[model samples]
Target chain A: DVKVTQSSRYLVKRTGEKVFLECVQDMDHENMFWYRQDPGLGLRLIYFSYDVKMKEKGDIPEGYSVSREKKERFSLILESASTNQTSMYLCASSSPSEAFFGQGTRLTVV
Target chain B: DQQVKQNSPSLSVQEGRISILNCDYTNSMFDYFLWYKKYPAEGPTFLISISSIKDKNEDGRFTVFLNKSAKHLSLHIVPSQPGDSAVYFCAASDIVSGNQFYFGTGTSLTVIP
Candidate 1:
């Protein structure tokens, strides 16, 4: 079975602080993605990396960035945390056919 | 514009009954469709999928049906169990672009014992 592990299950940050969410996959998939899920909005892509050091902005890229220094790890960075940024963040790795997702990190900004 | 849509926000079913979750997409370019199940505090897990070439795909108790003309798909869970309770999301992608999927808002399924 494929395993995608996330660094944190839950996090709380103050306004104007920076936040990092990490994800790692054991499957060595070539594509990694970051998404934020909100009620009635579904999962919106924030960023995605097709290869190491290669990143592309998804539909909702504002206020968020991503890093893929290695094939197994992908990280999402928030430049300045705000209350609007609070949501469940998910990481996914995929090949040609299927995608495996991490458990997700619930971030709350106060 | 929202490419994928799940009109129903929630559905309730009794155990041993059938549960149907529907999804519609506006983009005709999408050739691959998938269904995912997510629980609170957890990421969405891949459940089943169907390609545009095929009309139906079945796995165990879960089956996905696609209607290319209407750009719609539905997932049916037979003999629904309590464990099937979760938010179900429908996603679509064009495999030529390396499978970047667009998802629906999701439908919360509740199974009553």
Candidate 2:
């Protein structure tokens, strides 16, 4: 089965700490995205990479960054974790037809 | 501003009845619309999709209707089962922007048995 794997299902971090959430896809899809989901806000895109070494900012790119060194792996980085940044982070890879999502990582910044 | 909106935050329907969820988008450029079903603690799963050229698309128990003129869309579930209870999200893709999708806030649907 095709898979999009997120490194952690849950995480707890201290404020101001730099955090990394890694994602890997086995489908070799060129388009990959990172989104943060919250109550009453839905899934807001943080960033998306259409190809290796290429990235674009989404609707909400403030306070977050992304890296796509290889086609299969896309990493979302929280430069400095804050209490408000606590949300469910999701990774997705897409083909022309549809996008497949990971299990998601819930991050709590204390 | 939220480009896509799900006005109703929650909806409940009796078992074996039809459940309807609505969505509206502010952008007229969105050409492709999709519905996703999400269970708690899990990612949303793709449900049904409709292109701008088509007004309605059906897949088994689910049907999605798009009204291009009004910039609105609706998903109908026939005989909604308890298992159908979950958060439903409506997403839109602008073909001009390489099919990147924008999602609505989502509506929580409950099907009572």
DockQ values of all predictions:
0.76, 0.66
How close is every model to the real structure, measured as TM-score?
Answer: 0.96, 0.95
TM-score of candidate 1 relative to the true fold: 0.96
Q: Among the candidates, what TM-score does chain A have in each?
A: 0.98, 0.99
Q: Compared with the true structure, what per-residue lDDT tens digits does model 1 show for residues A6-109?
A: 99999999999989999999997889999999988889999999999999999999999888999999999999999999999999998777788999999999
Instruction: Write the residue-wise lDDT of candidate 2 on B10-108 in tens digits.
Output: 999999999999999998888988899988888888999998999999999999999999999999999899999999999887766674678899999
Q: Residue A80: error of model 2 in Å?
A: 1.5
Candidate 2 colliding pairs: none
Error of 1 at B5 (Å): 1.2
Task: Kindly list the per-residue Cα lDDT of model 2 for residues A1-110, writing each as its tens digit.
Answer: 98999999999999999999999999989999999899888889999999999999999999999999999999999999999999999999987667889999999999
TM-score (chain B) for candidate 2 is: 0.97
For each of the candidates, the C-alpha root-mean-square deviation to the true structure, in angstroms, is: 1.2, 1.3
Angstrom error at residue A66, model 2: 0.7
Q: What is the interface RMSD of candidate 1, in Å?
A: 1.2
Model 2: how far residue B74 lies from native, Å: 0.6
